[model samples]
Target: MPSSINPGATLVLTGVTHILVGLTHPRLGPPLLSMVRSGLFDSITGISLDPTSSGAPQYDRMAAWWFELAGAAMILLGISIRENINVAGYVPRGVAWGTLGVGVIGALVQPLSGCWTLIAQGIWMVGWFGKTKME
Candidate 1:
């Protein structure tokens, strides 16, 4: 048990960040793949289109889809956790920890884009009052 933990803010910020990342992937990830996928939206994102042309873009798209859903799920789960805990109930600590783990893994995987999540989730995890906070 930690001395101080503002589960509310933690859940809200982390949840929103995850949701935004997931939502943006679908909205923005496709254009970068236009040359590889063959479609309307066309542009360059600075990342070499070479890999996408190498047949790995298919898998890349699939992974992005997974991350999108994961983000949505995080939002829902975070809300549920906040609600359950605030009202006073048996919201298992494991649930929070597990969510944090998943979030951190995703953040670590894409530190460049997920930097916000990385820092936010890290704070949420430490379970500190002013700075870090985790379970």
Candidate 2:
């Protein structure tokens, strides 16, 4: 087993993961989608983008749910391997990377929606990097 792991790190990792999951998968609706749709809000929030025109909101919702699952997995991994040479650090890193990847892909296929999600993910990734430390 790895040493030098602390409860604080585990808590932080879990908290961050929960935040990501919440952001991606709210109980009512995807705030990210709503935020992406409102032009005024997006611009004011510095996340300007157009609303989704695709007739597949359910597909998007399902995708978000899967992403949340992935985030949960990362959280568990971080907690389980908290002292494994900074593997825990990658949980947020993976979240950021995954978000960025999705954003990029979204941008390529759907510029407005993609860019909006990218902005949100970018902000989250920035926070993740700033808040966490490698062990």
Candidate 3:
């Protein structure tokens, strides 16, 4: 089997999951109105309490979005590692394991429905480990 095939497919799938869920979750979530009023597009680049000062729920929504983006980036890093891309100090195998922890920790803060994502993350982490020959 080609080295790139496993991680390539995994990262692409994971990347799509993160990107789509992150982008759509805000509009489909509790803070839709607040996010739209506060310029949701800009918020993705950076977030401050000013936009979500209405309440804590709004802040949680933003935090979830940030995590989605970060997850996507981590997937890319994992794929890059498999490809042997020179990424300074990052190791893809480490990134893969680290994201599992992130997903587990996220469940503590996420709503019940959000636990599905965590479960999927856990499954993917285990699947990635078993499927990839990444060192």
Which of the numbered candidates is closest to the native, going by highest lDDT? 3
How many steric overlaps does candidate 2 have?
Answer: 0
Global CA lDDT of candidate 1, please? 0.52
| Model 3 regions more than 4 Å off | 1-4, 26-68, 85-93, 108-135
Per-residue CA lDDT of model 3 for 19-92, tens digit only, reads: 66765674544454456677877544333557744423445556666656765775776566556422232234
Q: What lDDT is reached at residue 101 by model 2? A: 72
Question: In model 3, what is the error at residue 56, expressed in angstroms?
Answer: 12
Arrange candidates by TM-score, descending.
1, 3, 2
* Displacement of the residue 6 alpha carbon in candidate 3, Å: 2.0
TM per candidate comes to 0.47, 0.30, 0.45
Query: Each model's C-alpha lDDT?
Result: 0.52, 0.48, 0.54
Query: What is the Cα-based lDDT of residue 7 in candidate 2?
Result: 34
List the pairs of residues colliding in candidate 2: none
lDDT of 1 by residue, 67-96 (tens): 656666656765665565445433455665
How would you encode candidate 2's per-residue C-alpha lDDT over 24-122 as one tens digit per residue? 455524644653565523112322254643343444445554555655664564454344335544335565566567657768887854245444544
lDDT of 2: 0.48
Evaluation by TM-score, superior candidate among 1 and 2: 1
